[model samples]
Structure formats: C-alpha cells, structure tokens
Target: MLPEFPMSRQCPYHPPAGYEELRKEGPLAQVRLYDGRTAWAVTGYDETRRLLVDPRLSSDRSRPDFPVLVPRMAAAKLVALVGMDPPEHDVQRRMLIPSFTVKRVNSLRPAIRRIVVERIEALTADGRRAADLVPEFALPVPSTVICELLGVPYGDHEFFEEQTRRMLMATSTAQEAAAASAALIRYFEELIETKLGEPGEGLLDELITERLGRGELTREEVASIAMFLLVAGHETTANMIGLSILTLLEHPGRLARLRSDEGLAAGAVEELLRFLSVADELQRVAAADIEIGGRLIREGDAVYLPNAAANRSPEAFPDPDVLDLERGTRHHLAFGYGVHQCIGQNLARAELEIALYELAVRLPELSLAEPVSQLGTKPGGSVQGILRLPVRW
Candidate 1:
C-alpha cells in the first residue's frame, strides 16, 4: 500500500520524515491523499522543475481530477492567476509583471526598509525585551507593505486576516472555507467599485483604470485577482519571516555573521528561502499524457510537487541539510519554477532581505523565548509555518 500523502513533519524546519523514503522510491511515487485517492508525489529536484514547466501539467483547480490535499481546499478553489493555464495565465501574468520587476522592487526598497524599521521599533517600544515576533514584527511588516501596494486599507487587516486564516486552515470545513473566500471576493468587489469612483495610486487602481476600463478584464475578475494577491502577498512572506527568525536564532554564528556583513543579506535570504521551503507543495494535474523520471502520467492524473523535498535534495544542493548563509544559489524552487512562478517574488525577496538584516542589526540580543518543541505550528495545510514565534531581546 502506498503511504499517505503529506506525511507530518516532526520538526517545523524540515520536510516530513517520509519524504526521504519517498524520494528513495524514485523521483515520482504514488501516494494516497486524504480522500484515499492516489496522486504522484514528485520529490526529485530536476523532475519537479521539469514537471512544473511542462505544458501538459495543468494548474486549473476546477478540474474534477485535480488533487485537493484537504476537503476545504476543494471549496476554496478560485481560478485566479495561480490556478490559470497559459494564454490566460500568460496574459494576466504579463499585466502584473511590470509591478514586480527587479527595477520596480528596487524602487520600493526605501519603503520596505522603512516598514521594517517601523515594525522593529514598534516591537521594541517602551523598552520591551520580549515579544511574539509573529504579530508584532513578522506579520505587520509584509501586511502593511502589501496593503499599501494594493490600496487596501491596513486598518481592516483584522477582518481580512481572520478570513484568510479560515480560508487557508486545513481544519476548515468546506462551507467555512467557501464562506471566507466569498467574503474576501465581496470585500475586493466593494473596494474596486470605490476605487473606480475615486482612484488611488496603487496596483488595484491601476488595474481598474488600465485593465477594467479598457475592457480587458471584468470588475469581478479584477476583484478576484485582488483577493488572490492580498492573501498571497502577505501570508507567505509573514510565515517566512517568522520561520527565518527562528532558524537564524537557532544558529547564532550565522546570525552574527549576517549582522556583521550587510552585503551577505541577499544571499542569506536566498539560503533561508531554500532551507525553509515554507510553502510546502505546489499542486497540479496532468493536462495530457506525460512521461518523465521513468514514470508515465496519464491525462487528468493529479500531481504533488513538494518544494521541501526538492529544495533539500542532495543532488541539487551540496550539504543540502546544512544552513549556509553564504550559499548564493538562487536556483531553489522556493519561489517555484517556470511561468507560474510567484509574481511577487522580487518583492518578497526585498522584504525578506530587509526584514532579516534589520532585525539582526537592531536587536543583536534577539533569541527564542521558549523551547522550539513548545511552539505551536499550523496544522495540515498547503503552507507550513509557526503559529506564534516567541522571542526575547
């Protein structure tokens, strides 16, 4: 019998214990999902990249054969940019590319640094020595940055954050997930309508004026896109920030080295991304017959590409288990591979670089306040992260 898919992770920083065994089985191995349905788990680095770029692999969530890790995800599927296939995916991706380009992200560096500093100051205010970095620092830095960039009022973060948590939580029921998604879509729709009447200088406004006004996209489509960006823009980065802090504090020598050498921050961020692989897996389905890694995938067959396993593959990274801040390789699948790769990756890179560098320098005494084992982690979900990261300075 095939092992159940998404084997639990004993340690938050590492992949599931079964991942190495699965990889040993071969690049692609059959694994049973939560529903007792089988899917191909792609564990090899080269194979995962090849499959990601293969045109025969479909990201469409609406496909009946599409694998849903948890029951809630079935109801939460909204075919936005990530879920879209080419032609449509290419078109929509191109529209948003300009905003996330290296130059554009570079231009926002000052703002990102400001946000990071603001969060750090807030966390350390009143001579505070300890804090749950998740809410005080990690969460707000990206949330505020994304909110500002998307024209969504940051004041309403509590409402949307709750909704996003519900939508992404693996424990959520189908109806609960659907309701949270619907609430977000409705919120974006209202925001779009308001921006239509009174414009602002943000991505949402630009999409409305350029795409919606030009008839290239409908209002609902724009809203859906906004909701997708709003959720993804913050959640992943926030988790990465929190986990990066924990990982760095665990290795004080590396943390000291990073704090002393500002130039190493960029490479450190990349290393952290590859090491953590925070977003666990990328789900897809075979659009047609495809053969790779000595395995045949028939049309409509579901596929799971676990980024954790791929990033840690010894074949791809020498000393893959060791955390080397100087490992400057950017080939890791942390931001994913191929065309559907994260649109805001440049922005994410900038945020992580700034946030980590600032925290290390500003609070040289920062350390974990509690045992790593005592920390709560998010339950089974598409993404994996610490629920609350307690820290002291």
Candidate 2:
C-alpha cells in the first residue's frame, strides 16, 4: 500500500516526517489521499518548480480529480483566484495585480512600519513583561495592514478572522467548512454592496468602480476575490511572523545579529520564509498526460507540491536543515512559483521584514515565556503556525 499523503510533522519547525521517506523514493512519488485515491507528491525542488509552471497542470479546485489533502479544503473551491485556471485565472489575477505591485507595496512601507511600531508599543505598554505574541502583535500587525489596503473595517476583524479559521481548519467537517465559507461570502457580499454605493480609496472600492461598474466582473466574483484577499492577506503573514520570532529566539546568536544590523533584516526574512514554509502544499490537477521526473503523470491525475519538502531539498540549498540568516537566496517556493504564484507576495515580504526587524530592535531582550514543547499549534490545519506564542522581554 502507498504511504498516505500529508504525513503529520513530528516537529512544527520541520516538514512532515513522511516527506523524507517520500523524497527518498524519488522526486515524484505516489501517495494515497484521504478518499483512498492516489496522487503524485512532488517532493523534489526542481521537479516541483517545473511542474508549477507547466501548462498541462490545472489549478481548478472544482475539478473532480483535484487533490484535496483534507476534506474541508473542498469548501474553498469558491475562491475565485486560487481555484481558477488559464484564461479565467489570468483575467482575475490581472484585475488585482496593480494593487500588489512592487511599486505599490514599496509605497506602503512607511505605513507598515507605523503599524508595527504601534503594535510593539501596545505589546510593551503598562510595563507588561509577558504576552501572547499571536494575539497582541503577530496577528494585529498584518491584520491592520491588510484591512487598510482592502477597505475592510479593522473593527470587524474578529468576526471574519473566526470565520476564516473555521473554514481553513483541516479537521472541520465538510458541512462545517461550507457553513463558515458561506458566512464569509455573505459578509463580503454585503461589504462589496456598500462599497459599490460609497467608494473609498482602498482596493475593494477601486475594483467596484473600475471592474464592477464596467460590467467586467460580477458582484459575487468581487466578493469572492475580497474574501480570498482578506483571508490570505493576513493569515499566512501573521503565522510567519509568529513562527519567525520563535525560530530566531531559538538561535540567540542570529537573533542578536538581526537586532544589531537593520540591513540583515531583509535577508533574514527571506531565510525565515524558506525555513518555515508556512503554507503546507500547492495543489493542482494534470490537464494532460505529461512525462517528467522520470514518471508519467496521466491526464486528470492529482498532484501535491509540498513546499516544506521542496524548500528543504538538499539539492536546492546547502545545509538545508540549518537556518542560516545569511542564506541570501530568495529562490525558494515559499510564495510558490509560476503564473499562480502568490499575488500578495510583495506585501507579505514587506510585512514580515518590517515586523521582524522592528521587534528585534525594539525588544532586544525578547524570549519565549514558555518552553517550545509547550506551545500549541493550529490543529491539523493546512497552514502550519503556532496557535499561541507566549513570550517575554
């Protein structure tokens, strides 16, 4: 029998234990999914990157053969951008690219810095020596930045955050995930309607006036896009911030280096992204038969590209297991590869760089309040992150 897919990580900082065995098998290995179906698990770095850009692979989550590692992910098919393929995906991605371009993200650096500083002040206020970084700092910094950019009211963050958490939880039942998704869709639908009536400077308002008013896109499509941005924009970055902090704390020497040198922050953030690989895996389906990695992928076959495994592949990086802040290479698939690569990567990079740097400089004495083993993680979730990072300075 083939090894089951999505083997659990024995350590949160490492890839799933089964991934090593799968890698040893070959770059492309078959694994069984939850529904007793077998799919190709692309564990090699070069093979994963090549497969990501291949036109023969489709990202259509609605397809019957699309490999969902967990059942709850089936409810995410409604996400207009990530679940789309070819002409449709290209069109939707184009509509939102202007907002997330490098120039645009660079312009937001001052604002991001301001948000990070404010969060740090709040975290250290009242002479507090200990706090949960997830809620106080890690979550709020990205949450506020994305909220301001997307025109979503930061006040309602708790509501949408809860809904998103439910929808993304791997253990959620199909019905439960569907319900949570519905609630988010409804919320975005109402928000989009309001934006249509009264526009603002945020990206959502711009989309409404430019695309929706021109009849180029439907209101539902707009809502789905907003929902996708709202969820993706914050959740992944927030998790990265928390985990990056923990990783740095474990390596006091590197943490001290980052604290003393502002220039090292950018490279450190890139290394952290490569090391963490917060998002579990990229999913796709074979659009046609393709031969690569010494194996033939039949048409309609499901493929799982585990980012953690690919980032840690020995062929890709020297001493792949060691976290070197000076890795200096941004060639990893933390934001994925190809046309479907993360649209918001620029923004995420800015947030991570700003948050980690500011935290290191502002609170140089920061350390984990609780033991690493005692920290909790999101249970069986597709995204790997600490549920709560108790820390002190």
Cα lDDT over the full model 1: 0.90
State the C-alpha lDDT per candidate.
Answer: 0.90, 0.89
Alpha carbon lDDT at 363, candidate 1 = 96
Backbone clashes per model, in order? 0, 0
Local accuracy of candidate 1 as per-residue lDDT tens digits, 239-307: 999989999999999999999999999999999999999887799999899989999999988899999
Q: Per-residue alpha-carbon lDDT of model 2 for 298-328, expressed as tens digits?
A: 9999899989999999999999999999999
What lDDT is reached at residue 35 by model 1? 91
User: Candidate 1, residue 195: CA error in Å?
Assistant: 1.1
